[model samples]
Target chain A: MGSMARAKVVALSMVDKHPEPQPLLAVKLSPAENPTAEAGADAAAPINSSALPAPEPEVVPTVSLTKVFRNLLAQITRERITTAALACVSIGALFLFWYIGTKYRVEFYIRFKNVPTPYEVFQQLTQVGLSNKYLVNIAISVRRILLGFFIAMAIGVPLGLAIGKYQRVRDLFMPVVEILRPIPAIAWVPMSIMLWPNNEASIVFITFIGAFFPILLNTIHGVHSLDGVLIRAAKCLGASEFRLFLNVILPGSLPHIFTGLAVGMGVAWVSLIAAEMISGQFGVGYFTWEAYSLVDYPAIVLGMITIGFLGLACSGIIRMVGSLLMPWLAFAPGGKR
Target chain B: MIMATAMAETQKGLIDVRDMGVTFGANDNKIIAVDNVSLNVQPGEFVSLIGPSGCGKSTLLSIVAGFVKPTSGDAKLDGNAITKPGSDRGVVFQQYSLFPWLSVRKNVEFGLKMAGLEQSKRNTTARALLDLAELLSFENHYPDQLSGGMKQRIGIVRALATSPQVLLMDEPFGALDTQTRVVMQEILTNIWQQFKISVLFITHDIEESIFLSDRIYVMTARPGRIKAEIKVPLPRPRRAEMTDTPEFMNLVQELKGLIREESLAAMAPEIKDRGLSGFGMKVGPKGVGDIF
Candidate 1:
C-alpha cells in the first residue's frame, strides 16, 4: 500500500508479541466498515489471544521511505531542531530583507539602487547559458582551496602538537605565531607574489596563511587541554614520549583539532576569494570581481552564494569526519558530532 | 602461562619504601601531601593503604609507581630506585581513567602494543586476559558504556595485562557501588592469587582493606604518614562470607579505630589553623576530589 501504511505494519509487527489495540490501524486498513463499540471491543480480544501464540502477523522488515524519514526525524533532537529552525529563520530573514529592500525605490524607507532583487538574481541564474564557465571557475577555486588547506594542515598540525606538549617549543614559537596571526591574509599577497614565482603559488600562499593560524592555534589548544592523567596512564603503561603522543595526545586532541580544521576551512575559503579577487583568473572570487567591473550585480550575488555553499559543505564534511573518527561522542548528550 | 610466570617471579619484599615523603607546589603554596610514609610490599603480597580523604595515600602509591618522586627518603622497586615510570610498573587509577578512545580490548593491549608486540600477538594476549577476567564479550565495548564496576574491573585487567613487576592501584575500587565493589574484590583476590604480582592497593574503605589485603597500612589524615601497619591473619582463598567471621570483623574494627584516630590527628592542625573551628571530630561541609 502506501509508505505510511507500510511503516505502521512494521511498527505493529515489532510489538506484535505484546501488540496494543489497533483501532487506528483497523480504521485505516478497512475504511468501508463503520465500526461499532461491540466490534471494537471484540477486535481488542485478539491481542490477548496472540499472547497464547497461535499465529503472529507476518514479519515484514521491508525498507520504506516513510520508515527512514520518520527515524531520521526522530533522531533530530529538540536542540538540533531548535538550532536548525534558528538558522533557517536567520537566513530566511536575510533573504526576505534583500528581496524587500531592493523591491523598488523608497523600499524599506531607503535602499541602495545597486542591490539587485531576488528574482532578478534567480532569473539571471537560469539564463547564464555558460554552465561550463561556472563549473571551471568553481573547480579551480576548490582545487586552490584544497591545496592551500592541506599545506596549512601539513605544517600546522605537527607544529601545534609540538608547541602544545612542550613548554620550550611553545616559548620558542608562541611569540612568532602571535605576531603572524594578527596580520590579515590580504596583506600577505604582495609579500607572497614577491616570494613566489607564479600568481597561482602567491594566491595559494595567501590562502595558506589564512588557514594556518586557526588550525595551529586550535590544535594547540586541543593538545593543551589533554588530560594529564591520560598521559600518566600512557606513561605508566610503558609508552615512550613519542609513543605517548601518538597513542594518547594525538587522538585526545582530535576533537579540538577537528574544530580548528572546520574553522580553518572557512577561513581558507575567505582568504582564497580575497586572493583571487586581488590577482588571479578563473575562480568564483575572480568572477565576482569581473562582474563588479562589468556591473553584473546578479553574477556577483551568484558568486557570493557559491562561496557560502562551498564553505558550508567543507565545514559539514569536517564535522562528519570528526563524528566518524569519534563514534562515542556521537551518542553522548549535547554531542553535535 | 599467567600462573607459572607469575609464580617464578614471586620474590618476597619486592617494593621497599623508607621514610617516603612528598610535598607539592611551589614555595608559598607548597603543602606536604605525604610525610614519612614508610611501607613495603612483599612480592605477591596484597598490601592496602587505608585512610580518610586527603591523607596522601595516593601520593604514596604514586611514589612507588614512579609518577611522583619522593621529596625525602626513597622508594625502590626490586632494589632499583623507582625514578621514572617504566613498563615494569603497571598502575590503575580510580574510575574514569580508562582511555575513552580505545576499545576495552585495545586498552588492555595498550602496553603490549607500546612494547612493540605484533598485532596478532597483542590481540591474542589481550583477548586471553579478557577471557580470564570474564570481560571477553566486552572487548569491543567502550569504557563509557560500561558500569562503574565493569570499568574498574577492566581497569584492573588493563594494568595486569602487561605482567608488570608490581601493580600500583590508587583507590581503584573507590568509585564502584557497594555490591559491585565486593564482587570486584573477589575477582581481584582471585586474579592476584593467579598473577602473583606485588600489589600496593590504596583505598579509603576499612573493611575493603581488611578483606583484600595481606597487610593494611593505616595512614593519618592530610600530610599522611603510616600510623599503623596491621597484618591480616586470615587464610587464603578468601570468600565474601568471611566478612561475617569474628576475626574479620575484629580486624575491621581495629582498622576503623586506627583510621578515626588518624583522621582526628589530621584534623588537629587544621582546627588550630582555622582558629575558630576548634573541634573534636567535626564533619566539614566539603568534598575531596583531588589526591588523597
Candidate 2:
C-alpha cells in the first residue's frame, strides 16, 4: 500500500515538474487523477488539434451538394432567359426589315426569278437541303477541302521537321518559302490552270497553297520551341541521337503541331469556298454564282447558308481532333474557348 | 589494416589523369579553365574536390565523363583513353536531372535500353534498382510528384542502373535542406559501400568533403589548380555520430587553413608593387572594394 502511494506521488511530481507542453501534460494528469471524471477533457485535446483552421476545408457548406445544385440550376435558367430574349430581338428585327422590303424595296426580291419574299428564303433552306442539286454541291466542296488539306499535311509536316532540325536546310528553304508565302491563294489560280490540265488539280493546288503555310509555319515554331533542357537531359541518359529525336523531340513538338492543324483546317475551308467560286462547276460557291446570274434569290440564300454550315462543321472537327491529340494543351490560348 | 593496404595496392590506380587542361574560347579572349593538373583515383575509393565558386571542379568531372575534351594531356579509365560518354561512367548532376515526362520505372530503364538489353531483362533491372532506392511503390509516379530528396535518389538509381565502374557526382546534395541532406548522405554512404564503386564527388562544403571522402582535394580559385590533397584517416562505413568527434574537428580546421591560404593566393594581384602598399582593394571600409 505504501509503495503504491509513493509511485502515484512520483508520477504526479514528474508531471508537475516538466511543464514544457503544459496543457498537454495537465490533460494527461487529469485523466490519471480520476478514472472516468476527466475522460471528456482528455478527448478535447485531439479536438483542439483538428479545430485549427484549414486553408481549404473538405466539406465546406458553400460547396455542399445542395448549394451546387442550386447554383447550377440558377446558371441554366439565366442562360435560357438570355437566349430567349436574343431570339425575340432577332426575329422582331428580321420581321421589320421584311415588312419594309415588302412595302418599299420590292426590287431586291423581284429581280430574282419568280420574285420570292424573305419567308421564301427560310422555306428554301428547309426544302433545298434534301434536293439532289444541293447534295451534289455539298459533296464536291467537301471533297475539295479534304484533298487539299491532307495533301498539304503530307508535304508540310516532313518539310517543316527538316527545316526545324537542320540550320542549313532552314537557310536553303526559308528564302523560297518567304518569297512564295506573301502571294495569296487566289493568285495561284492562273498558274495552276496553266500547270495542271484538269480543273480538279487546279482547285486542289489552290487549297494546298492556302493550307500549307499555316501548318508549316506552326510546325516549325513548335519544333523550335522545344525545351533545350529536355534534350540535354536525354543525352545525359545515354539516349542515342535517333531515339532522342524520335521519342523526345517529336512528342515535345506535338502540342504545337496540333495547333497548326487547327489553324490549317480553318484556312483550308476558307480556301475551298474561294477556289470553288473561281474554277468549280459543281460546288456551293459555283451554285451561288449560278443563282445570281439567273436572279434566283432563295437559291442564293441557300448557297450562303450551306457555305457557313460547312465552315462551322470543318472547324468543329479540327477542335475536336486537337482536344483528343493534346489534352494538356486545353489551357493553351485560343484553344476550345 | 595491413591486409586492406595490400588490397588497395593491387588496385593502385583505377583512374589515371595526366597533365589535363581545359581552355575555352579562342585568341585574345581565351581563358584557361583548368590548368595542367594530374591526379589518380584508386578502386573503391571516395574522393572529393572542394573549393570556392569557379574553381573548375565541375569541369574536371565533365572531362572525366568524356563530355568535354581537354586541350592538353589525357584522362584514362582503367588504362583506356576516354573519347566519349559511356555506361562505364555515371554522373549525378547537382540538379535532380530526372526526366519529367517519364515514370520512375521508365526513367530507370533508360540506361538499360541504351545498353540494348532485352525487354524482360530491362524490366527486371529497373525493378531491382527502384527497390534498392526504396522507390518501388513510386514506380508509376512522374518526377514532379516526388520530393526533392526522392528525385535525387531517382537520379542516383538512374546512374547506378548502368552498373558503371566509376560514379561522378557534382554536389548531389547541395540543394537539399540540412536535415534531409544528412539523411541522403547516410543513404549514399550505404549505397557506395554496397556497390564498391569509385566515386569522384565535387562540393563546396568542407565538412561534407571530410565526412564522405577517403581523400579530399582542395583547389585554388579562378585559374584552378590543386592546392592540397588530404587523406582522411577516420574509419569508414562512417556513421552520423562520427561527426561530433575530436578527429573530425581537427581535420575541419586543417582543411580550413589550407583553403584560407589558397583564397588569399587567388585574390593576390599578378603584379606586385611593395611601394604602393596601401593601394587597391584594402583601402576604406572592410568590404568597400566589392571584389569577390
Candidate 3:
C-alpha cells in the first residue's frame, strides 16, 4: 500500500511538469468525480497490470503517453522546423552568391577577381582543418579573447555598478569613460603596442579595450533601468546596503550585464584578430594576414571563416551561460531578451 | 494565539504622520506632491488613503515607508522617526514587485535571509507564508509564470514573510481584473486578520477602501491634503456580501462623492490647458453619436 501511495505521489508530481494543456494521464486514470481514489487505484493498477501483462487497462495510459509524445513533437517541429529551414536557405543563398561572384570574377566597385572561389576555400578549409599549426593559431586567438574579455568584465562590472549607484562615482568616472570610449580598437593598436611589454600583452590590451566600454555602458544602463520599486521592496524587507546590492542591484543588473558580455565577446574577437594581424607571429588573424602577404587567397578565406566560426561560438557560449544563470528569463513572455 | 502574543510583545506598527508635505524640483519646476496630510494607524488597524489620481496618496505611503522624505512635518513608526526604509515596515507596490530572478519561495525567503536566518528556518518560514497565500504548490514558479493576481499575491506574501510590524501597500490591487481584485481583497483581509499587523493601504478604489479598511482617509487633488476621514462600521472578517449592504453602500457613496469632487478638481486645470473641455461640449458633425 505504501509503495502504491508513493507511486501515486510520483505520478501526481510528474503531472506538474507537463506543459500548459492538461496531461492525458489524469483523464485516462480517473473520472471527474473521486479523482484521488480512482487515481490511486489506477496508479497501483498500472504496476500490477505491468507485472501480469494485462492488456486491457494498460492500453489506455500507453496510448495517452504516445499522444503526449506526439503533441510535444508537433510543438517542437512547428516552431523550430520553419526557423531552421529559413536559416538554411539564407545561408545557402549567401554561399551561392559568393560562388557566382568569385567564379565569374565579377568586378564592380569591389573586385572579386582576386577572391578565392568557393571550391578553393573548401580545399583550404580541409588543409587547414587537418594542420597542427591551424589548431595552434585558433587556440592562441581564443586564449587572447577569453583573457581580455574576462579582465574587462572583472573591472567593468564593479566600476559600472558603483558608477550607476553613486553620483560621486558616476561623476568621477563618466567623464573619463566618455572620452576614452570613442577611440576605436584598431586605432588603439599603436598605443597598445607601445604600452604593453610584449606582443601577446599588446594584443590582449587591444582586445580588452575593444570589449570594456560596451560592458561598462550596458552595466550602467542595467543598473539605471532597474525598477526602483524592487530596491524599495528590498530595503523595506530589511536588506542592509551591502545586502541590497548583492541581493537586488547585482541580480537586477545581470540581464544587461549578460548583454554586455555577449557584445563584449564579439568585440573582443574583433580586436584580438585585428591586433594579431598587425603584430603577431601565431594567431588566426596573423595566419590570415600572412596568407594575404603570401598571396594564398584561399587560406585567407579559410582564416576568415575560422574567425567567424570562433566568434559565433564564443558569443553562443556567453548566451547559454547567461540563460543558465537567469533561469527565470526563460519564463519571460516572447522568450529571453 | 501564543505565537501571536509573543510576536506582539512590543507596541509596534503604530504609524503617525503629522502635517507631512513633500515638494519636488526647485524654482519654476517646483511641484508639491502632498500637503499637510496627517493621519495615524493604530498598531493592528487597517487604514486606507483614497484619493484622485495624482493626489499623492502613493507619496504619503512612500513617506511612511521611508522611501521619500517629506519636505515638512514628521512621520514615525512606533515612535521612531522614519528616516530610511527599514525591516520594521514591509511594502507592497502596485506593479507586483516580485524579483523576476527569484522563484516564489525565494522571493518570500528574501527578507528572512537578509536578516541572516539560516537556510532551514528561512525555508520553513517561506513555506509557511506561501501556504498562507495558497501558493505553496507554486513555490518553484517564477513571477512571470504566474498571472497578475497570483504575482501580486506572492508580492503580499513576500512582504508578510518578513513579519514586519506594518505593511504599506500602494494600490497593490490596481492592476488586477475586477473579479481578481475582489478575490484579492478577501485574501488580503484574511491575511490581515491572521497577522494582526498595522496596514496603511493607498488606493483610488472606493469600494476597496471601504471593504478592507477600519478607517478611510480621503485626500484632495494635487498638493494632496486630507479631505475627510470616515470610520467603517462594517463587521470583521469582511465578506463580499457586505459590499451589497446598506451601510457599506452608504459609506461607498460618501467616499465616492468625496473623491469625485477631488478628481474633477484634479482634472480642471488639465481640461482647461489641454482643451479637453471640448469633450463635454456638444458634439460636432463628425461625432460618433451623429454616425450612429
Candidate 4:
C-alpha cells in the first residue's frame, strides 16, 4: 500500500489502541472524490479505504537563484527610495514654512506692511560678526545657558540618585519637588528678582528650575529601572553595598541620566531665552526683544534661528555622550528618534 | 553499572549546615522562609536539593553560599562558618547572571577582579576556566550574542575563575531546553570530574538529581527539614543513559514519592484559598519540564 493508505491504518489503530472517545474531532478530512477525480476513482478508492493512511509527502527542492537576487534587489531599492523621499519632504517642508512666515512682518511702531525677504535674514546673520553687538548677545546667552545647565546637573544627578535608590529620601523630597516643579520658571521671575536682586541671578534661577525636573526624573527612573536580576547577580557575586551601587547601579542608570540631560538641556535653553528677554540686560532673548523694539525683523529671525541651532547642537552633544557611555544599549532596534 | 563506593565517598561532609533558619519582612509581618534545617555535603560530591515550591531549598542554598544570612545557626564550608559570600563559594544562578555589557572574557574576570588579583593572574585564570567550559573560542562575544547553553557556560567559567572550593549552583541548567540541558549536564559532569570541587546543586528534577548527583538531599515543605539523604551509586562521569538504569529508576521513584508527600503536606489552607494549584509542579508531570 501507498504511504497514504499506511497512514490511514496507523490512524485507525491509534484510535483503537487508546480506547478513548475524543469528544472533539479536531482533524478535518476532505472528501476523497477530488483526488479520485485527479487520479482514477478506482485507483484512489483502495488507498482511501485501506486500514492505514500514507506518511506525509516528502518536500521537493526547487531553487531559482535569479528570482532570489531579484527579490533582494527590489527590497533594497524600495527601502532606499522611501528613506530618501522622507528626508527630502521633511527638509523641504521646514524650509518652505520658514521662508513664507519670515517674508512678512508687522512692525507697529514703523507701520511697515512688507518686510525684507528671508535672504535678508541670512545676510544679517553673516554681517553680525565677532564684534557685532548681536554677536555679544549670542555669547552672553551661550555662557548663561551653559553655566545654568552645569549647575543643574551638579544638583540634579546626585539628588536624583538618592531619590531613586532610597525610599525615605524620595518620600521626603518628592513632596517638595512636586510643589516646586509645577510653578513655572517664568512665573518665578518676580520671585527671583526679589530674592537675589540681580538679572543674572534671576536668569540662572529660571534656567535651573527649567532644567531640574527632567534631569531629576530621568536619573530617578534610570536608578529605579535597574535590572533586578543584575542586582541579584551582583549580590550573589559578593559585591559590597558601595561597589554594587557605584559599579552596577551607576553604570546601569546612565542611559536614563543621559535622557534626562537631553530634556533638561532643551528646557534650560528655552527658559533662559524667556528669562533673558524678561529681565536680562544681554543674551539671545534680550537681543530678540531689542531687535523687535528696533523693528529689525532680520535680526529677530537671526536670534530665533541661533536659538534653534544651539539647542540642536546641545542635544546632539548629549546624544553623542549617551551613545559613548552606553555602546551596548546604542544598537536598540528602530533607534529611538 | 552502579557502585556502592560512590555512595561511601559522599558520607564525609564537605558542607555542614547546622539548624539554619531565615525570616523576611519586619517584626509583626515576619514570615519564615527556611526554618531550622541541617544538611551535610561531602567533598568531590554532587548533592541535589529537591523539595516543594517555597520549601526554602533555594533559601537553604543561598544561605550556604552566604548570599542570604540565616536568622539562626550556620552554614559552614570545610568546618568554617560562611558569614558572607566569598570567592570560595561559587554560585550559578537560574537566570543568565552574566554582565551584558562585558564580553565573555571580562565577565569571567569579574570574580578575579573582586578577589583583587593582578591583571596577569586574572587573565590566566579566566582563560583557563573559559577553555575548560569549552567557551574559549567565544571569548570576545557578549552574553547577549550567545545561546542559552553558552551563556550558562560563561556563568560557570565566571564562578570557577575564583577556583571556588564549593560550586554552589542554583538551577544553572534550569533555563535550558531538554537537549541542551543534557549537553550542559555532560559538560558539568566533565568539569566536576576535572575539579571535583564539592557541588551543592539545587534542583527539583528527580531524573536530573539521579543523573548528576552522588547523593540527593530531599527536603520537606515549609520549615524545610531534610526528609531523606539517599545515596546515588551511579559511576563517575555519569552518562545520559544512566537515567534509564534500574538503580536510577528506583531512586527517581523514591524521590518522586518523597516530593509528592511533601508537596501534599505543603498544600496548606492558605495556599488552597489562594488557588495556587500549580505550586511545586517541578517534581511531577504537571510542571516537571520546568526544573532543569
Candidate 5:
C-alpha cells in the first residue's frame, strides 16, 4: 500500500483492534502532544511506565538485523510507543494467566487445560491467516452482520418512532416486542431456519432479531424522554404535526437513536457468530465449530479472536458515525465548569 | 385568507379573556387553578399579569397562548377564538425553550420556516431580529453554548420572528440572575416599543412588571381572579432608573401589599399542611403552587 493509505489504515484500525473500551485509559495517540498526562488523569496510569521496557535507541546508525528491528521503534511517536507498551503489557498479562491456568490444567468446574494457550492461538492464526477458507469464513460473517444490521435499522427507526409518538401504536406492538425481546437469538434458530429458504437467510434473520430490539426500544425511549417544552414550543410556533416531527421530534430523539444503533451493532455481531455456528455453510462461527470438532484448539481460539476484532470494528464504526452525525455532542462549549 | 378574515370578524377584542376559569382534575378531587379571570391587551399595548406565586398567572397566559383551555370563558385574539396554539399568538416560555439542537439563528428562524417563508426571507427575518436583539454575533452558537441571558434573548427574538400579532410571554426573565433580569427587561421594553406589538407578559417580579408593562394586572389568591388593574402612568421609553422614582416605587409598594395579602391567604393554615404557601402562586395539589 501507499504510505498515505498505510497511515489511513493505521488511524482507522488503531481503536478497532481492541475488543473492550478503556475510555479513561484510551489516549488519542497524536504525535507526542503529551497524552500520558491525559491518560493518567482519566484511567489507571498507563500500565505503570516503569513496567514498560525502555524503548531501544534510534535506528540511524546501527544496521545489525535484530538491533535494527529493536531500534526501528524510534520511528513511532511517543504516544504510540506508550500505547503499544501498555497494550503489550495488557496482552502479556492475559497470556500469563492463560499459560499458567492451562499448564497446571486448573479446573473451575471442568479442565481449563482444554483451552489452548496464547502461543497456540497465535500459531493457529499464522497458519490460517494465509488460507482462503478462513478469509471466506470472515467474509461470510461480516456480510451477514452488515446486512442484518442494516435491515434492523431500516425497520427499527420508523417503527420505533411510531410506537414512541402514539399511545395506541405502542399498546398494539409493545406486547409482541416484550414477548420476543427476552428470547435469545440462538433459540430462534429452529424457527428462523423453518421460515427462511436457506441457512444464509436464517443466519441473517437471527442477527436481525438480535439487533432489532435495542434500536427499537431505544428510539421509543428517545421519543418518550424528549422535553415536552420543545414540542410545545414548536406547536406554538405554528408547526403542523409533520413539521413538528421533522424539525423537532426527529432531531430531539437522535442522541437516543445513536445509542441504540451502537448497542444494536454490538448485539448483531454476537448473534451472527452464534447463529452461524448453530447452522451455516460458512462463517467464522462455523469455522470455530468445525475446528472444535476436529480438536484444533488453536484454530478455535483464532476464530474467537477474529470475532472479537469484528465486534470491535462494528462498534468503532458506529461510534465514528455517531460523532459525525452529531458534531455538537463532540464540541462542548468552553470547559464543563 | 378566509380564516384570517373570519378571525378578524370575531376578534372585536384584541385579546379577550372573558371570565375564564380553569380547574385541573375532575369531580371531588378537582382543584380550581384559575377562577373567572377576565382581562385584555389592546393593540400595541403591553400588559403585565403579576400576582403572588401560584396565583395562576402562567395558567392564564397558557390559556391565551391556547396551550390550555378555559373551562368557562374563552380567549380570543384579533376576534379569532383561540383554541390551539398558533403562530398568530407567539409565545416565549420562561424556560428559554430554544431548541438545543438548533443554532441561535435557526432558533429564531424556526417559526418563519414553519410559516413557509422562502429561504432568503427567513434568513432576512432571522438576521434582522438577531441584529435587533444584538444576538447577531452569537447567532451560530447553540443554546447550550450561550449564557442564560443570551438564551432568553434568543427566545424573545424567536417568538417575534413570525411577526405574530400579539406576543404572550410567561415570566420570560424569571430564570436569569437579578442583574441579567434588569438588562433583559430593558431589552424587552425596547423591542416591544420598536415593534409596537401588543404584549401580555406574566411575571412574579413586581419591579420587572411595572418596568416593561403598559399596565399591570394584580391577581388574587387561589381560584385566581383579577384583583386590581394598575395602569403604569409612566411615560413611554421606560428606563431602569424609573424604578427609583417615587411614583414607580409607590406603585411597586401598592402592588407588593396586594401580593402580600393574597400570599398570606394562599399560605393559610387550613390548607397549609399540603405545603401550600408558595410566594406569588396558587395552591395546586402538585408539589408547589404558583397560580391561584
Candidate 6:
C-alpha cells in the first residue's frame, strides 16, 4: 500500500509540472475511482509537489484539466496561495514598469535612456554568471565584508560593554567616540589609505569604521536599558560583580546586540562597496564601477542585483543566528509576566 | 545531629534595623524614601512591611537586602552590618526577575552555581526546589513561557535554592490575579513553615499582610515612618480557611482603616490643589462608590 501511494504521488507530481491533459485526467479520476487512493496520496504527498516528472501513469482515468487544477489548488492553503500570488504580481509589476521605461527610453528628470531593459540585464546576468571572474569578484567582496564585520563585532561589542558598564571608562572614551562618530566612512578613505600599509587594508578599515559605531552605540544602549531590579536580584543571589555581568548583564543585552549586528551588516555593505569602487582591485563593487567606465550598462545593473541579493543573504543569516541564540523570545508574546 | 547543632550555632536569619533612613538626590532635589525606621526579625519569623504607595516599605527592604545604604542608621544580619548583598540573603522581586535566557531549572540553580557548587549538586538542588514548587515538569521551560503565578513561584523557588538565611520579597505576588495570589500565599506559607527561614516581605495588600506575617509594620505616606506595629496571634501550619475567622477579619479591618487614613494623607496635597479640602468627609458617608 505504501509503495502504491508513493507511485500515485509521483504520477500526480508529474501531472502538476508538465500539465499533460491526459495525465491530469488520470490524477483527477484515480482519487475518485479508488476512494482509499485519495487518502493514501494525501498522507504521502510531499510539501513541494513540483519535483521531477514520472514517465508512466500509475492510474489512468478520464477527467478534465480544469477539474484537476482545482483539486490541486484545494489541497494547499488558501492564504499561502493568495500571499504568494500577491508577491509575484507586485514583482511582475515592477519589472513591467522597468521594461517599458527602459525600452521606450523615457527621458524624465532622471533619464532612463542609458538604463538596460529587464531582458538585456537578464541576458547579461546569464553571460556573466558563466564566467569564473564574476564568481571570484563576488567571493572577494564577501570575504572582505566578513573580515571587516567580524573584527567590528570582536572589538566594538567588548568596548561597548566596558563603556556601558563603567562610568569612568565611558567618561574617558566618549569624547573620542563622539568626535569621530559623525565623520562619514568615505571621508576616512584618504586618511585610512595613509594610515594602513596597502589598499586592501584601507578598504577593510573603512568597512570596519562603518560597522563599528552602530554596534558600539547599540551595545551601550542595551547595557543602559537593563533592569536595575534584575541586577539587584542577581547580586542578592550571591553573584559577584563578574558573575553578575555574565549571568545578567551579558544575556540581558543580547537582543539589542543582535539589533546592532543587523544594522551594522547593512552599513558594512554600503561602506565596503563605496571603498571597493574607490580603491579595490577586484570585487563586485569594482566590477560595477569598471563596467560603468567601459560603458557596459547591462553588467552594471547585474552587479547591483548581485550586491542586493548578497546583502539580503548576509542580513538573513544574522537574523537566523539571533533567533537561534534567543529561543526565549519565541515564547515572549504568549506570556508577559 | 552535629551538623544541625552547628547550623543552630550560626545564628540563622536574624534581621536588625536601627533608625535607618534613606535620602535620594542632594539639596533641593532630595527626597526621603525612608526615615528613622527601626525594625527587627527574629530567627525563623515571618514579618511584613505594609504601607501606602510611595511609602518606604520597599526602600526599607532594599536596605536590609544591602542594595541601598541608609543615610542615617544601619541594617544588620546576625549582628554584623549588611554592607553589601551576600549569599546569606536571597531576594525575589515583584517583576519576577528570572533571566529570560535561562530555563526554569537553570534560574533556580543560579545562586548555587554562583556559590561554586558542582554541576551534579546544582542539578539536585534545582530539581528538589522545583519539585517542592510542583514545577518539576516545567524545568526546561523559560520564564517568559510561564504565567504570572508560575513565574512568581519560580522566583520564590530560585531565591530559596541557595538556602539563604533570610528571604526578601518585594510584592512578589502583586502582579498575579486574586485567585492565583491566594494560592501563592498558601504555597509561600507552606514553604516558610517547612524551611523555618526568616522572611522580610513588602506589600500594600492589607489582607495579604494579615494572612502571611507573624508581625506586620504599617508605614505612613512618603518620607515613610513606621506608624504601627501589630502582631498576629494565629496558630502555625496556617490554612486558607483561617482567613475567614473572626480574628482575621478584625485584623483586616484594623489594617484597612490604618492604610485608608495614610492613603488619604498621601492624597492631601493633590486634594488641596484641586480645592477639595473636605473631599474625604464628603466621600465617607457615600461608601466610596458615589465619589467615583
Please count the clashing residue pairs in each candidate, in the order shown: 2, 0, 0, 16, 26, 0
Grade the docking of candidate 1: acceptable
Pairs that clash in candidate 6: none
Cα lDDT over the full model 6: 0.87
Please list all clashing residue pairs in model 3, or write none if there are none: none
C-alpha RMSD between model 2 and the true structure: 15.2
Predicted structure 1, TM vs. truth: 0.80
**Alpha carbon lDDT at B174, candidate 4:** 86
lDDT of 4: 0.78
Off by over 4 Å in 1: A1-97, A104-106, A109-112, B1-13, B24-31, B268-292
User: Which one wins on DockQ?
Assistant: 3
User: What 10-residue stretch in candidate 4 chain B is worst by lDDT?
Assistant: B1-10
| Cα-based lDDT for every prediction | 0.81, 0.78, 0.86, 0.78, 0.82, 0.87
lDDT, candidate 3, B1-292, per-residue tens: 3553454456578888998989999999999999988899887889999999998999898889888889999999877899999878889999979999999999999999999999999999999989999989999999989999999999998888878999999999999899999999999999999999999999989999999999999999998999999999899989999999999989978888888778878875655454555655543456667889
What lDDT tens digits, residue by residue, belong to model 3 across residues A179-286?
999998989999887988999999989999999999999999999999998988898998998998899999999999999999888888888888898888799999
DockQ rank, highest first? 3, 6, 5, 1, 4, 2
- Which TM-score values does chain B get in all models? 0.87, 0.88, 0.90, 0.85, 0.88, 0.90
Docking quality level of the chain pair in candidate 6: medium
**DockQ, computed on Cα atoms, for candidate 1:** 0.48
Of 3 and 4, which scores higher on DockQ? 3
TM-score of chain A of 2: 0.66
Off by over 4 Å in 4: A1-81, A98-117, A129-131, A166-175, A195-198, A331-337, B1-13, B25-30, B267-292
Compute the lDDT of residue B24 as modeled in candidate 1.
90
Query: Against the hidden reference, what TM-scores do the models get?
Result: 0.80, 0.69, 0.83, 0.76, 0.80, 0.83
> Per-residue lDDT for A332 in model 2?
38
The TM-score measured for candidate 2 stands at 0.69
Off by over 4 Å in 3: A1-78, A104-110, B1-11, B27-29, B269-292
Model 1: per-residue lDDT, tens digit, A177-286? 89999999989988998999999899889989989999999999999898788899889889998998899999999988988899899888889999999898889899
Tens-digit per-residue lDDT, B83-168, candidate 6: 99887998989987888889999999999999999999999999999999999999999888889899999999999998999999
